[model samples]
Target: MTRRTVRIAMNGVTGRMGYRQHLVRSILAIREQGGLALGGGEVLWPEPVLVGRREHALREIAERHGLTEVATDLDAVLADDSIDIYFDAQVTSAREEALKKAVAAGKHIYTEKPTATDLAGALDLARLATSAGIKHGVVQDKLFLPGLLKLKRLIDGGFFGEILSVRGEFGYWVFEGDWQEAQRPSWNYRSEDGGGIVVDMFPHWEYVLHELFGRVTTVSAHVSTHVPRRWDEQGKPYDATADDSAYGIFQLDGGAVAQINSSWSVRVNRDELVEFQVDGTHGSAVAGLRNCRVQHRSATPKPVWNPDLPVTESFRDQWQQVPDNAEFDNGFKAQWELFLRHIALDEPYHWDLLAGARGVQLAELGLRSHAEGRRLDVPELSL
Candidate 1:
């Protein structure tokens, strides 16, 4: 078998999601598995060149991971002719400029979304990448999760039988820096730093709804900063200018309504930190990060509401678990493998920069819907 190496310039490895999911779980895990087999006796391997503003951090990660290449200069990294891909997991504010440079350098682009801080910027990246004829993709990792995958299976198999609505609850309490160090970066609470639950999570919701159910046609939202003041990384108090919680109602193309609540202030009571329940005429299913449970119309229980009587029905116990018929991989890794295949083998990939732009558009409209106190239509984006 012929082995082909694709050199990737990976930026923002110093951050949590970049380091943990993209670098370690996805790229490194693929390497450990002896690279990805592209049929016809060809194997595609990843060679990562770590890029960041901090030379010390880059060098530290390189050494720890037994990697050789580390560069603080992005321009120099981009100039390397051997580099096949440029991947970014940086903050929203910084992503557009970096991705633009990568496109100029003729590198295949793969990055975390919003794609940019706003819809215009996201569309610009899409246009640039499309013009450059580069194989570009966004990190829509949730689509590959075991739970969502199972849910997709159900959708494809007609288990839903005319889906009616979707209800999603996603959140967990993030520690304030004073008593305990904040679980998320301090920038997440500051609007000036491009921090907010709306911008952060609405993108995920957009793709999930568009892919699994239907394209979101309209959105109504109410956003708030439930925790106005929080301590920073240094244990200093700062006013949180961004909304920490957001309640959104999305109208899908097929007359299905999706209501999702995203919050950093709420405590988790569900089986997973995030879960979505989809109801249909025939059945209903609830899916989380790793598990999915369904209650068909035949098995669904009916209960009478009475204040005078104690509840006797075990509602949770009635749902049947979705079996994993095949081995499941880490969601991030699975998407990474598909992206790699798209780059090396010319496999069709749908989640391009345009899809990412759609996500950004949803977020922008969601925030606008909250501010204007009305539902907004989601126009189809074209580049």
Candidate 2:
């Protein structure tokens, strides 16, 4: 059995999402699981080199993760001929330039979503990657969630005869610095750092709705800065310039309208921190991160409007839980494995930089819709 190693230069391994999700949960876990089995006695080994500006932090991460290689110089990493992939999990503001460099080096590129804050930059990266003939992908982790997978299965099984509409409620209270130390970084509340609900979340909604129903034809959005002032990491108050909440209405190509509310200001009243309710002619399903509940039209109870009487029937009891018949892996890791196969075995991979640009387009149009107080058309990006 011959095994091949794909050298991966991981940039921005110090950040929260990068460290916890991609490093520990995805790549490291892939390494621990004997790398990716490429079938026929061939294994795809992920040989990762930690790349970051802070030497101490990189060294600490390498030591903790049992990694051998660490590099502080981006130029050196680009110059390294052994590296086959350049992964960018850096902040939204710092992505394009580094990715361009990776493309110049002819490295397969993989990055986080909202590939760039603007559509042009994302398209430019796509152009460079295509010209270089390098495989590229953007992280669409939400598509691989257990609940979403189950929902997709039900949709494929025709549980929903004809999809009609969707409602998504996503948020939990992000504490103001006045009470408790904010869990999220303060930069998330600053627009200068590429932080805003429109930039951050509209991309997710774009892909989710498009995948579940159809392409998003039009968007009507209302975004706001829920907390104007928030305490920083050092306990100093700073003006939060970025929008912290968004209320969006997306019209799908299949005539399904999806309304999603994302907020850090609101308290939770739903079953999960994030949930999407899809209603159709035959059934309705509510999906969270790990669980989904369904209510068929036949089982639906007829509730007469009665403001004067206490409701006796348990509304929640009518819905049946969707069973998890199969095992699930980490969402990011699942995607990582697919990307590895794409590079190693020339597997079919569709989530490319062009797809990422579409996500950026959605956010851009969403912001425009909010500002103009009108619905905006989502133009398709054709290469």
What are the runs in model 2 whose C-alpha is more than 4 Å off? Answer: none
Prediction 1 TM-score vs. true: 0.99
Structural similarity to truth (TM-score) of each candidate: 0.99, 0.98
Model 2 per-residue lDDT tens digits across residues 69-125: 999898899899999999998888888889999999888999997788799998898
lDDT of 1: 0.95
How well does candidate 1 score on lDDT at residue 114? 84
Root-mean-square deviation of each candidate, in angstroms? 0.8, 1.0
| Most TM-score-accurate candidate | 1
Q: Give candidate 1's error at residue 320 in angstroms.
A: 0.6
User: Per-residue error at 301 for model 1, in Å?
Assistant: 1.6
